[model samples]
Target: MRGVVYFIIVMLVASSLGCISEKIEKPDKKRIHGPKTKKIEEKRQVDSTRKRLGVVSGKWEQLNGMDGGDMHFIYSTRSGVLFVSHGFGGVWRSKNGGESWEIIKQEDFTDVYFYDMEEIGEVLYAGSNKGLWYSLDEGESWTKLKTGFPEIDDGTYHLVSLAKYKDELFFTAVLDKKYRNGRPGDGRLFVLKRDKTILELEAPANKEITVSAKYPYLFISSPYSGLFFSTDGKRWRKILDKKTTNVFVDGKYNLYVGTIGDWWYIGRKIGNTWKWEQVKIPGRKNTNSIFYFLVPDPINENRLWFGCGGVSRFYSFSARGFGNSFFGVGCWNGELKDWKIHSNYATSIAFYGDEKVKTSCGEATKYALVTVGRQAVQKTMDGGLNWSNSYEGVFGDTINAINPIKSGILSGTIVVTAVSGTEIAFNNGEEWMKGIDLRLGKEVGGGKLPGYPWCAVSPERRIEGKYDLLISTGYPSPFRGDGVFGIDTSCLVRGGRNCVKKLIGGPHYEMVISEGKLYAGNMDNGIDVLDLETMEVSKIDFGSGVPLIRKFDGKLFFETYEGKYLGDGWRWSGKKGKIYFYDGRVTKTIYEEYAINFSVNNREFIALTPESLVYKPDFLSEEEIRVKLPNKKYTDMAIAWEKGIIFLSTDGEGVFYTTIDELKSGGVRLKEFNNGLLTLKIRNLVYEDGYLFAGTRGYSVWRVKPSQV
Candidate 1:
């Protein structure tokens, strides 16, 4: 057990004693888990058996980028800062004019969506679900405008348009669900006066007012009142009796009024008689209905760019949400791609495309392995550019785990776990041999054999000065690992009942090593540690459920599982699994949620969560740091500090990454590194040689190079 091998096989059955050797790594601090005075003393060194993978370096390949997320309001400031509201996510601003964008406020617009945003002078006015909000400091902060738009019966109000008239800012608070039934009265057209007082404009609510400096008259399109034109902002004239959807007046006094059912009425003045001609919209055929947009084209005079929204469909399990009405993004540029005709909403079109970050490709390692989820295990010698899976299509079930040991008696050997149990690859991945059945570790007839061939690892150990593989049952498997079955490369099973006793009553999946002893913590059983040299199983309990345990520097730190459930709130489970810390029988309540799959490196305790990567320097007195992820459901993350990069494995959206230092200090950017990922559900991630590896749930394992920074 006094070894730097990555093998963590925890078996706690009584056995004869052997000589005990130690590779003691000293600690500066230890957490006293005793009652009353429970506390973690100081920091300590990291002497982990398995070293971390990946490097801190280089440029990455190409990705479509910014392809996901729902689109909301799009605005361009006077300084040419283009911003798009990415649905549930906050505002994404493009500094160099939409060449790229970074999320400025990722948590904004969670409760509501933005309706409209326009820059007036220096302040940026935005109409949202909660009335009009003006941002004086560019988009950093926002304050609600008290322009007669008080909160209705519902908490939020629907603000549709914000316009400036006669040196005053006017906002039209339109019909919401509370007011749509004509109960909360009419929509309010309020204006912000010069003295900062909000005064109600003498105009009908629920009507969109179209203003143009080139035209003498202002047109208002109302659902009930049709089209009304005002000459002096007070005098009104009924221009058209037809229900107007959108009224647009260009610079040359040409009016293009759109109605329901894809009708566009173009009106222009010739001397005195104004001829209004109706025409069908072109280039938008085979698309869904059009919603909010009309940008006058500077390049093409006769045509206008429109936002032809997504297709509408009924909700059902078979539909899979692809038939949404707000999905399609349309353009009248005389060209259409196959994807444009599909049910995808494309907003905020920009040709200024540039990569947000550049990475430099570094040298690759000679040996690399690839394990697909239900497929073959391939290996490459020329740095992953080429792979060979000679024994493919042999296993009917999916391959789960791949553990390659380099310098042991089973050197150049790999251990694989799948639905049918463990398999071994003798020469890197050329040939694989089926090993023991997966049910060997489980109780004889307990609840049928678990299908998923979960944890499998072969730790390198020297028994009686003879180097042999003495590890099994990787830490915290799909379930309780049942027991450890030590086997050699040639299907030679080493440990039996004498090897590991039958574990019952509780799950024994999560395993760790400390003080020359292998410790296992399960959901039910309190705790059990195995002294490898003497080879004896000893159970330790604190009277409660030990859900999580980590062994560091001869001390045991554990948390009692309480009310952690899978389906709580909008989360599967949080990394905050520990409420109390324990060492031996000593216990102390830290009152912090630091980790679920916790790992400590250089005193940095990394807490991997579905939402964010929580980081702290130590158990106590360390400044807490959190790196927010763009998407939820983060499966795995790998930090390559030497090359200065950290890779994040997103569930369906592929991988994203950022620098190590930037992540620790609330990042400014985290680029998606999905160059070759086919599947969305990425389960595992690792960094080897110069490639960032992603183990997807479907398709196959993907590898990409992290360009050198």
Candidate 2:
């Protein structure tokens, strides 16, 4: 069955048993089965096919893992200079095969956010939100390309893709006429010849255009426009009229185009004629799958790798249930009767080399390095048979919460709960170590993993004179029940999963330890008090749960949520929220507003709403003041009381800082303080030792000195 085309139809059930033929007949239209029976039968077929193909499994490890953040594009030049671009994190270069990475910071390209990057000869070209950029010294520095595009800063043209045919470099620039208005625009192709001359041509489609080239053949795949081909780099002709998402030209010149529809068509040029086959992954029927990424095998030209997700080429936002039937990295060699499904939800990939290395599983070879969508950068040394997470020296996941150990032997240490698991930083904010086992990757049915650690609190008390940590786990929609778990800080430094104990069961948005008691503010249930000595539990209910909790000057204050749930960490739905002062006896609603989270100091209480921050001074005084902020949704806030500084994190924008004295004098100037950060989607913030730790949505934890800002 190698190198054969098989048109799979409904009656191709026998193929699941590792048998295949040239063609399959259609099923009888009159035949029908019950929903339950049909589902079971389909599962059986999929299981059989996957088992026959020896479903590749391994523990994934991160490579070039320097808190690289969420990757937008990853490409490696022929000379082995790997470039990975993070939209706001800037572009990073790894010369030693991802062993270490450094951000490419240049004077002229500080704010340039690259969407695509390609190398022609020794010059690297990048397409950004502003304009096109080129680097001559392997990304040591960069210079903007002077293409005479209209209003480069005003978003007139956004270069999205780049390709090369012979000696000429071709690029696709989307003419974004709306600019700051945030709307889609048309795209066109431009040719950059060796003589520094530019030639413009009409693109096949207006938006969502992609270009790929391999020597004599250059192809463009545009969603809703069709696949186009060109040999001389100027004139083009349509090859397939399908809603294509991407085009991949293998080393052998075999063309593959992925579509958004039911069938994926593989286009192969035989002689002067082109042949197309509607192919499917053996056994499974992917009626809605988006093959937005494709890469040829570095060692084998026949094998084609792919990445699947629900994102559409036409739209920027992810559409649910569109192409989510399969989400991961997979490969198809055309010669095989089945596809080789690899890692999970990888949007981009880059090969290191074709060298075969010795592995634990017999004599296998190392493969590629892939960015696993805000999780980690993974590498497969033994062809995906076994894997391990390579997060050493890399901070690539989202940091959900940060806890600074103020007491005990691990004092001054910063412990954080990220998207992957728990990490502890003992040396101020310089390095991090994953020593605690949080059981992060435990599956919770429906093909979903449990929620990550949302909050952590380190108490002064110790067990066996060793440091301990109490972490609460939860997300917007957690697959498992949220609860607080305690773990010994000394275990699992060298990869062990023991020394963990569940202390309490419930979703806790905020937690604080006062004296010998731990007060946790739950979103579903009301406040729960746990005595550190006896581990006894007590509940305080005032008709609703609290979204925010604090311990100030021997007093417990919490915010009650009489609003809708916003599907986040104890998020206060914009309806109503009241901060109450709890004195261990009675509760008083001191301040009421539409606040979600807040930070407090000795003088005033700074509350964060959906739109801006609310300042209440004079010990919960009736004066409710609204501070001005940029028109961005704020998520979390923190305060350095001694320094009189306040920090705010946004959902889209980066971190903003202001002084508390400025708020009192009605001159609060909230300024953005993101200098070395890579991501703008800040999730939470905390302050300690003049360093402000920002937990971003994708880039993990980035710390900045307030004095520098």
Candidate 3:
């Protein structure tokens, strides 16, 4: 069995955790107060090392989860390790078929992505947008293999596909509108020979290349022309006039051609001259759309999985998507199981209230906005009933966060969103405006690579009676130091294009304003607190520079380090990681454990440990209902008071939500509130007007009402 399967293991860890013990007040070990009004100087140097000359660009990528984006490539090794690549820079390997998987590696460089992987003899090879990678130790580790590969002029290269043809190996290169030697870079296919370094095939360039599993046929789905076939590698044949989007050859050597409407195929060795028949997708007979990849499932010997509707401009939204999805994928197993799509890889989702929009019976309607990968921006005016990208000028390409905000009293609640890079744009409930660089003019080539850029408005302590736009260049290093920029909100409203952006360059857990003080915790070196009136910066001697300062129950709290158990690669820095409450001068250690991520809702303290989302109403109660979702790790969360639900954004697997009333009931059913989300891996989530907006890795963004789910 070597395919993606759903396995939910219900854990009753919540059963016994309610009786867990609690320790309090290690006074001397707690708070690290500031040296009164003493200021600290900058010491860390700005190091922009690797990608100085390269144009840094990244699509919607998630630094948190593993399972997302488009499933680009999947290769099963003889050793039983199945390597799969998706959107973002997600690459994972499963040893026990596709039932159990582990994160081999994630993104490390600029625009980290893998497209194809193959098991060549003993060594496994992978083709990525950046370059080629090979694993010698059964995918335990991977190393870049760039022996003779040419570096493109843009510094980045896209190796689309790779396959073995009998004894000779062939690879396909994807060009990105850049020209070289009077030829488009995307238009090249080459074969590796024993003596010769490389040999270009007779096949057309710039088109997608694919090979048959056992047959000696090579097919190219051309971006310029239609389909081109090369039987002997040296000679080629064109299937002209037949507009094909993609091609695939099954293990039975069945040639399947994908067109804009429906699919056509021809069976094995039926002679060079055969009839291509339009076939129904096993169970989905009426699905009038094209598919990308066709692969025989290893688990169900005769079954197949279709990488449906990918992110391509060829995927015409005007003609309708694969039912509200551009990057929608599906699989057909057996007669009983039938045809099904378990997930939708949504990147980021948001909502904008339209008081003007109402139902026929007359009820106010709120527009739901979602970025479905290359499908661009999709909106559902009447909730999730009908989603369409009909509206023009929305720059939804790889957006990270989509926020609906009231820019001004007259502007109303429109869209002010951030893409994967450093740019942030606003849409005044009509069309998208030109995005502004949050970097302003600072150098982002070095440690400052393109990350998930986020924007926020100062909630309180208005500087000079005016609010400032606080923007952070996504999570460059998880919960560590991220780029924070403060600009006067008035400047943006007044169209002050070249306004001065105050760049507080350093690492911090989080920066915020409370009681007229700007607290920048986890400075990497030390914690810094700035006075709003004086603009004086004083170093707070927090025990750990990695301080996650959060406000809960009218008091300020922070984390020192990680505790007991770990979910993933996060360092469990022993007993150092504990919850501490700050009382002006000193701190008090409250709950001790690995409290990396925590939140407060309705007077309850919620701590996210490796094991569970521990909740405590008060510090006095020794009882803590440590409930956890089915996921190993999760992303951000939102507490919907009206819905009385605690929504958790997962690393993968969309949102896991449960009602606060149910948590008190002890035996709770933590339901998955994902309806239209194709990708399980979620990066960010927000709940508004009974709608939950989710930001995914590859599927882009999607929204579904919790009550509807």
Candidate 4:
């Protein structure tokens, strides 16, 4: 029965196959096709793609590194060679002024100590923890001259000053004598001669001579004995014998002494009689004060400079003119002049001023606005000509978004989705209104969104008929997302009391308002176009690919993973995907979409990811193409258009600026700040008035003004 069934099934299948074959023998007349042109068209497309790739050739110039450390002193020799000694280990030498530098010598023992350097003939002498080391051949080799000095049991020695008096070398060494409890200092002073003979001075017990100087006669100051004078280097005489901390000898042989009790005295030698007069140091009575060093003007002997507050204060003096005092890390013209504050907490000060005027800037200005990481905002007015703190109120610290409404009006806002709240401030950052509950549950379809908000606006949006502001937010989550908030003068004029309306798009998106139409590049969704008047939304798909859109030359440019295209209002169904061409020819393969920013002049556009800048001449006759950038990765850039300057904020370093001519001339000139650097993860660059504002991650907002830079 099984064999009969199998035979019957096989016979039925053969009959069906024969019937289908008979039908296949006669094709339908309507199904007939034409001659092939696909091969010819395919060859043309390949050649076109290759031509596009050949146009853009070179890469961008990489940014130079900005090393960090407190440079305590910078000195230049008579030959115009510059040297900088860090408060830490290294000593840097600059052959060509300070345009470039190289480390010459550094040792572990010299770390974290102030070095007193003096040049005698061609030899350079340095005093550090390891006693006195002399380099006779300009730092080529070193010899330790610690013999004949008091033994430093704990291997600690501090040399405060070195000077040459009457053709004899004099140096002051503080030896740390061991005690039963292992504490330093039984208070000993030593005088070293030019011939390396060390004579120990008999310092009073329980007192230490903090500093010593020579003007042929050795003068040392003690906390217990006012002043001690040694004319022959061994036997010391207690002259004034009042407790003094610092002593200096003037050109007229007048001795100036500063005491620990906040008083100064001057003693003049007249034949056989010495007269002592007490002087007052104004505005320094109640402060922790100590006079450290003094410098007389090279061109003027009557002019004297004093360093006080242990290396912080500076005072200038003259024979009859008003003295100038600098209370902080700044300079002074004369000792009687009023104190001027240059910076809030200046780490270092340098002079590039002329004789008639002395100008000093601080290192703190570097991280002014853009130093804050996430939730940082910076704003300035007067086209970056001047700037003020605008993030004080909003974040109660610094913020990431600094949206400026006008010259005197600014807002600092921060969005943290995890906290379920956002912060907003108006009135130029004097105060902030925070905890604006984003009713996400009632306002939109929400469970728990993955990212925070990033805000941006179109160039056409106006604020107060003067400046323009676009507020944006970005997701702090793993997935990069953005949200944009639109504000007008009416909202800002009301001090942000009015609820500013939100434009369309979600966490990871960008909203660009062009020609009165709002265009959004969505991460999950395709590009969405919304009519400003009717509030109608239209979505254009790049066929399973995400599209990033930018508006240029009065048209919308869309880029996606597949290709590039120019969208016509509603649909991207245009001419297959035309590549950017020069002389009416196709260019290279369109890479994956990322980010872009305009140069200061707006004549050039910089595209991110495999970072590159596209230059298009103002006239159409000139060729247009993309040029690759240096190897360092950059996420965003800000331009000071008037200055022809560009600032790139990096991840590991800080903000750097260069000129547009340098970028075009194949030279990359970058100026990196040592201070005021927030996290390297900068997201946005915006300039308003005279200041350049930057937004960073974790570090919130930072700003730098032209005057400050």
| Window of ten residues with lowest summed lDDT in model 1 | 1-10
Model 2: per-residue Cα lDDT over 61-111, one tens digit each: 111212534455567778877776654445667787776666665545443
**Global Cα lDDT for candidate 2:** 0.58
Give all candidates' CA lDDT scores.
Answer: 0.43, 0.58, 0.46, 0.39
What TM-score goes with each of the models? 0.41, 0.78, 0.44, 0.36
Tens-digit lDDT track of model 3 for 53-158: 2111112222221112234445556554555554454455655434444545333333345566666678777777666677789988877755375662133456
Q: In model 4, where do residues sit more than 4 Å from their true spots?
A: 1-68, 71-88, 94-102, 106-114, 146-154, 175-184, 191-207, 210-215, 240-243, 258-266, 272-286, 310-709
Q: What ranking of all candidate models by TM-score puts the best one first?
A: 2, 3, 1, 4
Model 4 error, position 419 (Å): 29
TM-score of 1: 0.41
Q: Which prediction has the highest TM-score against the true structure?
A: 2
- Residue-pair clash count for candidate 3: 32
Where is model 3 more than 4 Å wrong at Cα?
Answer: 1-467, 473-483, 490-497, 523-526, 561-576, 628-631, 688-690, 699-701
